[model samples]
Target: MISYRWLLFIVLFVGIFATNYLAMTVKEPLAASAAFTLMVLSVYGLEKFYNRGPEKVTDERTDLINMKAFYYGSLALIVTLMFEFIWLVSEDYETAVLMAKYLLMPFGAMIAVVVLSKAYLERVM
Candidate 1:
């Protein structure tokens, strides 16, 4: 049987991909937001299912791995944002909000991937 963690990973990856694709193709905020909402719900549900109720003990290794992943992911996001800012400034762009939103996509995706990986490893190993 496939683990819940792998299911979550697949859901998140597909959701993000579909959201971005729809955002680009349809250019509809509502559609993109719906896709994002699905991703968030899946993650939350998996967390609750795995760590709460009958499963009283939380996985320490999963937590540690998630923390480490988050740290590195955040650092990389910061660096990417800095470079994007530099590029935007060089190009004489004045849309700070837009730039921030653009940067958020990758950052959010990275966090999702990290969390999914931790959950997957926890279940498999």
Candidate 2:
């Protein structure tokens, strides 16, 4: 049976797609929405396929690794966000348009930190 998490992701994808489509004033909304939906479904399917394994058993070690990874990721996110804020404030940002463009850096930093930290922790611990 499908889970609520999957439904939430699908809804988020559709909402994001619709928001961007409307904002960009795209001509072919139908085709774009169909393609976006297909892409989201394909990714969801791929994740499901990849996760078809035995049920996960978490223990102290696994929990510690995850905790540390999240800690590092949060640190990286905060640092990057601080830097982004400083840079933006040093310059001139009339609206949130420029701030929106800069937001990806912190997000990428967080993801990179989490992935790398998890990989390293898994290997070492």
Best candidate according to lDDT: 1
Clashing pairs in 2: none
Per-residue lDDT over 1-125 for candidate 2, one digit per residue giving the tens place of the 0 to 100 score = 67757865776687556535533445444444455455555665766776789967989998978885567557656645544443443343444357766777867876787788778988999
- How does each model score on lDDT? 0.66, 0.61
Residue-pair clashes per candidate: 0, 0
Runs of candidate 1 exceeding 4 Å displacement: 54-125
- Model 1 RMSD in Å is 9.2
TM-score of each: 0.46, 0.42
lDDT of 1 at 2: 77
